[model samples]
Target: MASLLDEILFETAGQGPPPSKDFYQFFITKNEVIWRWWKISGRTEFRGTPPEEIKMFHHNFLDDSRFQEQLAVVFGNKILEYTLGLCRRHFDYLERLPDQLLLKILSYMSIQDVGRLSQTSSRFKKICNSEEIWKLTVLGHCDMITEDMEMLAKAMGWKNIFFKFYYKNEHVNMASPAEEEDKANTASP
Candidate 1:
């Protein structure tokens, strides 16, 4: 019988398609992108070998506990995790993240991501609807938000829209008077 470690290695090795140009082009789904990126990054971690020296040993390669550290440095864990989750391809792992951390991560993704994540599951919908996350997720795209967007927005309710509108009015530029009108009004005054 194969040793436990051997089985693990074997299983991981066959879990993905070979890294060829054609395979990467057609077979690499959004879900697979994270899996492949994680594996490549994990291989990049062997201390003796530089990232370039580490090669594709097998289809499966990710085994890095410290991957988060590198990611945290580059994108910030808050954003990185959220971006991964928002991709809607890692729902299982994404759902398992701690609520606070997940919420922080959600804040870093775009409105479209938030909309997609809200459709993933009821639990995700609840978390995505929170004022803190929803506020940051939809920070500036009021006009782009449509009825489809409001499926998630319903969870947030009118109060959220009112608050966002209030903030937008207070802070964002709404309009500039026409130059001619301004000149005419100024002359009349």
Candidate 2:
């Protein structure tokens, strides 16, 4: 399996009523979690008053309460909570798959299954509802498709085209109303 890595930078106010801004960088990889913090100081005399602190630990350390307490002490409760949520989000394997591969996999699924999967996440919804996927579905299941039909698909969208052809058992005329009017005018002349 491929390893995943994610990094996030955020500002937090630490124990100050006026909200002193500090930068926190949280890096989570397959095997470790690293966090670095830097306090922003605006005083001219204390230009480098506070320095950056970096800490790294094995993934297993997250299970220890001592580690959590240490992180809370250093990053404040809100930052720690936000960082933990990022860590959890990084492990979503299906969401990390490439769109092309996901579309290929979805092509194999039944339309009903794809519809249900679309409701699961925004990414899935976009992929499941995309024209490319619907086009592929139409091409795979339909016996005959023509250039004219493809032009119609482009105008009406692949999903609409697919349902119209697949369920209604009718051919869609690709000519626009302007083209039909022109044909009528030429025939009258």
Candidate 3:
């Protein structure tokens, strides 16, 4: 586990794609990158050798090509870009929010706002069009969830159900959801 230095944004540890028996761990906190490793060898010279740790502030981490290459080898490019962004202060903090929390926050926004937010990024678009968010939207809009509604959602997906029953200014009338789906299907090309 990566030790928490204040608050960590990115962390991982492993003996990656391994043949050698050394363990490596690295973590990125808001202001620092800390890399730690332990030597695990049966050789007489390495016996009882202490674990090693290196800590560098964001700018120093960005400037160190050796450390950056080590990061690429262990963590890959996405994390490298993310850590670089952290160092540069181009903070993409919202993307780091847990999906559940982001979905909860999205559920509170009007559908129009969500539609606009979807255009801002692929991540937002995915969450905006996600089944979980649609389910929440449906539950929020309706006072009750009938057995028929549950069946309809299961069959057509929650987002489809929401669009079929309640998108735009349209609300469910005294019509069957299945019948509505049939009408919609037949009406489209």
lDDT of 3 at 13: 86
Candidate 3, residue 108: CA error in Å? 6.3
Off by over 4 Å in 2: 3-20, 41-53, 64-91, 167-189
User: Which pairs clash inside model 2?
Assistant: none
TM-score comparison, 2 vs 3, better candidate: 3
> Alpha carbon lDDT of residue 88, candidate 2?
55
Residue-level lDDT of model 1, residues 1-189, one tens digit each, is 112112112101122234421111111222232322223323435434422212222222234435435334444556445534433333345555678888888777755687799998898898877765755556454546677656756776643774565546754553445866887788994
The predictions' CA RMSDs to the true structure, in order, are 16.3, 13.0, 8.7
Candidate 3 residue-wise lDDT, 1-189, digit = tens: 223223877788877446668888988887889999888888999999998999999989989999898877776877788788877877666776778989999999988899998998898999999989999999998898899988988899999888777885454344668988999999999
Q: List lDDT for all candidates, in order.
A: 0.48, 0.70, 0.83
TM-score, every prediction: 0.29, 0.59, 0.60
Q: Model 1, which residues run further than 4 Å from truth?
A: 1-91, 135-159, 162-189
Alpha-carbon shift of residue 152 in model 2 (angstroms): 1.4
Best by lDDT: 3
